[model samples]
Target: MKWEDNRESTNIEDRRNSSNYGSKGRGGNMMALLPIVKILLGTKIGRIVLVIGVVAYFFGFNPLSLLDSSVTPSSTQSKVVNKDADDKSARFVSAVLAQTEDIWSEVFKKYGATYQVPKLVLFRGSTRSGCGFASAQTGPFYCPADRKIYLDLSFFDELAQRHDAPGDFAQAYVIAHEVGHHVQNIIGTLDKVQKAKQNFRSEKKSNALQVKVELQADCYSGLWAHYSMKNFNSLEEGDIEEALNAASAIGDDTLQKKAQGYVVPDAFTHGSSAQRMKWFRKGFTQANLESCDTF
Candidate 1:
């Protein structure tokens, strides 16, 4: 938690000021046209047009196509950046990223390999990623295609308020977990997992494999914490507890139960609450690569 005095990473790409808000998600364009549709439907002439459009729709003529063509998704939205307010949060992220770089670099040295550091991207509402166009709704993730970590600092606030997992360490754990994915990417674990997932015909079986991958990342996060504490004595009181609470809070079972009032293990891509906490503890206590083999 003593991160302010720590070194900040220079590999950060701050795109917070230039917000890209366009989303090509399903029903996104339709949702954008809602206000226009509501106004049109409120008019008497619009009712006639709507009835004619419905008849035309049944007759193989589409009127909605014209409306769809006219609506352009906003690609660039200017967002005022509060430099003073975001400076501390950005520094904290940079500090955590620096720690991961140091920890992983040292860890990779033991294996006789050079650690290729990944870039961390900071964006506001939305931005383009190598994987795809992403928004804050996507949360923090590592895109193997670009070898970069995309993050919106606002997710930390959501983590605290919505998930009941707060604290600096919890935020660090998130960055560490994404970095763990990058570790998997460089070490060929991600490629192997992707190939294996492709071989599975059943969605459930594939999801099970994904759970293994996520649990391993959780373990690697704990591994990061282990080295971070040993090397820099960074952990303070309740730090580990904050991370565990975070891991538990974001567990597939916990989120599913919270959202739907029930849990479906078959649909779980990430492990259960107990499984996540256990793997994290395993890596922390064992502090070895062998102990993190969730596969």
Candidate 2:
């Protein structure tokens, strides 16, 4: 939380100023063509038009380009409004990322391994990721395929306002949680889980495995916080409570109860509020890899 004067990470990719929509507004153009395509597919002649349109698309031409107001290049290239606030958020993210990089690098060294630092990509509204096209709705995620973490600054606001998890440390915990996934990827936990998931046909079994994965990541975030606090004295008075509140706020049971008025334990992809808080506290207190074995 005390990050204003801290070193900023160079691993950040600032794509906030670039257009978040698909290339040349192709996504928008497709939306415009959907109604017409739906109507045309109802008749033989319309089917022919659909085929022609498909062929044109393959040939580097778009019939949708003929539609007026479908090709707004300026709209796609416009600058971000409220740049000042976003810039401040970007700085804060870079500082926190740098802290994670430093702490994780040391932790990996203690294991006789070099830390392969992950790049963090920052974007607005939407952007392309190695896993797929990502929008703000996708939230903060780590894509193992690209070994990159994708984030939208708006999520911090939503975390504060919607989830009632305000505080800079809560934002830091979110970043650390995703970074924990990268650590899982590095340690082959993700690979093992993927293989283990293949052995289960039941969705409940698969979700249980996923819950372990998520809870382990939560523990790893606490692990990071432990070393961060020990090494740099970084935690403020209420930081841990902020993170715990966030963990509780986004818990499977809490969210399920809010959305559907009841809890379904079988569908839990992340643990209950108690489970999350327990694992995180375990890692923080125990401060060892063995303490984080959620399986």
Candidate 3:
């Protein structure tokens, strides 16, 4: 939680307020078309003549050019920009990301494999992505297509307020977990899982495989924690507890019980609450990639 003065990440891409509707800028052309349509349709002022004039106006024969893509968007918040985070939460995320890039790059070097440092996208509302479109509702996801991590900053608020995990370390765990997916992608583990899923006839079996993947990511996050604590002195009073609490709070069982007033182990995609904490602790204790082989 002591990350106020830490260095900010240069790879942060902030896209907080972008609109998906094409033809940007207050929907001006569409708005203009609507009123014209109303007048032409409702009245009988030589509808054919109106159509010609309307067509001419919409086709750039009009005085104002409303077709520019740049002017179409009503706001620029959704396009990545360097908006000053200037806050404790945002600053901590940046530092954690930079640290992961360092630790993972070195870890990969030991195996003689090149490590690709992933970009961290900090967005609000929604934004376009190579994998498709990402929204705040998508939570945190890693796109294998682009090798980037997409996260909505509001997720920290969700962790603190909804999950009862309100520490800087808890947020860092989330980031590391997503980065863990990137690790899997870089190492070909994720591609193998996808192939296995294709042949898996039973949905239940595939879900089990997914749980292992999720748990492995948790373990990988712990591995990062071990090094981060050792190298950066990132640990503080109750940091691990905060992460454990978060792990438990978002467990499939816990979330299902809360949402449906019941628990179903058979339907869990992520590991059980206990499993999540166990694997994370395992990684933290072992502090190596060999220790994270949950497969």
Candidates sorted on lDDT, descending: 1, 2, 3
- The TM-score of predicted model 2 comes to 0.82
Q: Indicate whether candidate 1 or candidate 2 has the larger TM-score.
A: 2
- Per-candidate clashes, comma-separated: 0, 0, 8
Scored by lDDT, the top model is: 1
Give the per-residue lDDT digits (tens) of candidate 1, residues 1-295.
Answer: 8888889999999987752434343267568767877887999998788789779867855455566753223332324356676778889999999999999999999989999999999987778889987777889999999999999878888899999999999999999999999999999999999999888999999999999999999999999999989998999999999999999999999999999999999999989999999998998888878999998
Model 2 residue 88 CA deviation in Å: 1.3
TM-score of each: 0.81, 0.82, 0.79
lDDT of 2 by residue, 1-295 (tens): 6778778999999988764444436676677678888899899999998899789868856466566442423333324567787799899899888988999899888889988999999987777888887777788999989999999888988899988999989999899999999999999999999999999999999999999999999999999889878877888999999999999988999989989999999999989999988888888898777899998
Clashing pairs in 1: none
For model 3, the superposed segments whose C-alpha errors exceed 4 Å read 17-87
The Cα error of candidate 3 at residue 145, in Å, is 1.4
Q: Global lDDT of each model?
A: 0.87, 0.86, 0.80
C-alpha RMSD between model 2 and the true structure? 6.8
Worst 10 residues of 2 by lDDT: 70-79
Candidate 2 lDDT for residue 267: 99
